[model samples]
Target: MSPNGIISISILALQLWHCAADLCNWTGSGFGADGDSRTVLQVRLRCTEGSVRWVYPGQALRVVLEPNLSYAQRTTVCIKPSRTFRGASVYIERAGELELLMTDGGRPEQVFCFRADGPQRPAIYLQASPQSDVSRPMVGFRYELLGNRSAAPNLGHSGLQTSCRPCNDTELLMAICNSDFVVRGYIKNVSHDPERQSSLVEVSGGRVYWQRSGVFEQEEGTVGASRSVSSWHGHIHTLLQCHVKPGGGEFLFTGSEHFGEAWLGCAPRYKDFLSVYQTARAARRNSCDFPLD
Candidate 1:
């Protein structure tokens, strides 16, 4: 399962499928191009790899994608893109790529391909049946990739520095649950705390905004839960940490002001950061509790 426990599949007919259609291996015979029996680039089916999530100090999530292929009817094949890269919601990131295996199976073993990392596109594709003398073409093909990540998926290939993130309103509250940060926990205290140090966040849905940390620190400011905004039914979460010293330490939560309400409400969903990123991209929409404005 690669080093990160990601199961690899050389072939994917069905069940637990994650490989690209292009990997199916295309040849000279084949079908319609993109246009028709005559067009040179017909889009059959497309499947994409997951996104990237959290990586520690030095790690990277690598993904390779290609199209399913075959040349049953005088067809020439090429890979359309089949992989992507994503970052946290708070920050903006351009589309990214992974190295793809050559269709012909030659020396340069792999090349790079980009996944649809923009807004609104999900990881999906079509499997085209080349137009032939017969009604529905009989021959079909598949695609594949060599997807794997480093020891720390959270870190990028460049070893981007990553800090702790207070998920959305849900996880943020959960993170706050056991801490002293919510000393007043009344969701009523929308005001920033000048004495308390750490970021706060509240997720209503997919929206995400930020609030300043009240406590003094030499690092980035803290964000309150109420800062995120649930937009267009998509989760947009941001992680804000109450800057503390390096190394493992204690997370002091001040519980809600309510007599029975718990602070930081619950525990954030624990997941690999790189996985989170890739999942978000492939789904084309996030499912986080976005903080409000």
Candidate 2:
């Protein structure tokens, strides 16, 4: 049982399962041929051998992730779950601290937090437990990090800092690193797709004309539960708190896609966000990577 009165399941018997496939580690920056740097790396934990099959009451699965933190100022750890992990709650044990950062009893797609002030690269302990009865065992999990924040100097693009709310570096980095297409553009237009009509997006580099729905699709038969669509679909999302005016100003946008069309949404409020995208773009150029699809 944890100090917080949560009964977590410890590793009864543990073995690194398929270290090559599961351990998807990468450096946020400072990529070298030798690969021995204090960059953040991703790791996976699986219950190859465990104490229980069905997650009973008062039992949870806990896996600790410890990365080399010698060269980094701080680290941000994010856990992405596979489809098998159902009815699970995420708990993050802060490095060098006993207090835990957990979801508000909700099933989150991903759990991420920053270890800004730790004595060392403390082991980021990630634990997940079932919230439902007779749930399936947690087979494994994956983690990723932006490893070289400290070594990389501030690129004079610390986000548009206004009195209202400051831009979060972690959020911007997550969107930038995970996105397929990052663009510098403007919001072409805003309209309601009552009949789900296609909208045209005018960007600086290029133009995107496609049919997309901005409305949140609810489950079938849950009519009227759907959310009203927004005009910011192909432009940029406001989460990054960008200084965006309708059909005005050039902004750095990060993009993802579905069904062979570009979905421009997440935007980083830094001038140098383009540089970050360029870095990722250069790496992907050789592979002929999938662009915004």
Candidate 3:
């Protein structure tokens, strides 16, 4: 075989090696000859959540998400770029066409989400920008795949707009029953992050009925006369557009957890929730039995 033929065969073997490895977290470097700059490395990740890092990126990389999902259900994919992410642009490939998802110079704190429904399985493509120095920039992002049962409604765009609209009676009832955590709390503080376009709501939970994840924990310190020693404290994340405010009244906080972070869902004032719950209960329309304090 010619020397050039042998070099081509070697590159083909390297590409195949990367494609065959199913990993949850992938870290690789793209540094090679001029011909290798045109090579597109393929990576397959089968996990529901993971991260990908490309160091000194030169050639393009294609990431295929093949999480185990039910055919009858829909799936949502969300990616959060690392704060230090640089030197690459991300695109979603559907039907052999590319749709730009994140620009190389875009806000790193911002998250992007899209629906991965339909017959065509979506894949992420990372195209590296031209380099001028030997700075060795790293491009990376974390990803999560949410199924229909776990995904919040309308988790498109930034995935933070799910709580923009107030939930209706039926949705409210269902949220308390299906959410990861149900708490009776008051907003202690509300902080907005413009960079991420999100709001962080600090909650002082008086009562935690149930919590799938240990997101809310008991506060340590002297308890006030009106406060319970068993009171839990936690933060709930929501989009800044929701404009969450710290009010005086207690509320029934119900929400789901994503990637270990608690997200706000349907929250109604305690009194209003009681009125709704009682009315639904009397009419035999409540989704599930919720203990009242």
Worst 10 residues of 1 by lDDT: 84-93
lDDT of 1 by residue, 164-256 (tens): 544544234333323322221112122233332223433222211221222211223235955543221111111223332222211222222
lDDT of model number 3: 0.77
Q: What is the lDDT of residue 23 in candidate 3?
A: 56
Please provide, for model 2 over 1-293, each residue's C-alpha lDDT reduced to its tens digit, 9 standing for 90 to 100. Answer: 46673433232232221112222231121122134322222333322211111122122333444444343533544444434544334455443343344433333333234443455443333333434544444433345433433212121112112122333444455554455455555556543322222233444433222223332112223336675432223333222233334545556655543223343445444345545545656666322232342
Backbone clashes, candidate 3:
0
For each candidate in the order shown, give its overall lDDT on alpha carbons.
0.25, 0.37, 0.77
lDDT of 3 by residue, 41-113 (tens): 7788878889898888876888888776553253678888889988998877665456777778888767788
Identify the candidate with maximal TM-score. 3
Worst 10 contiguous positions by lDDT, candidate 3: 3-12
Over 4 Å off, model 2: 1-22, 25-58, 66-74, 80-86, 104-107, 116-132, 137-142, 147-182, 189-237, 240-245, 249-293
- lDDT for predicted candidate 1 compared with the true structure: 0.25
Best by lDDT: 3
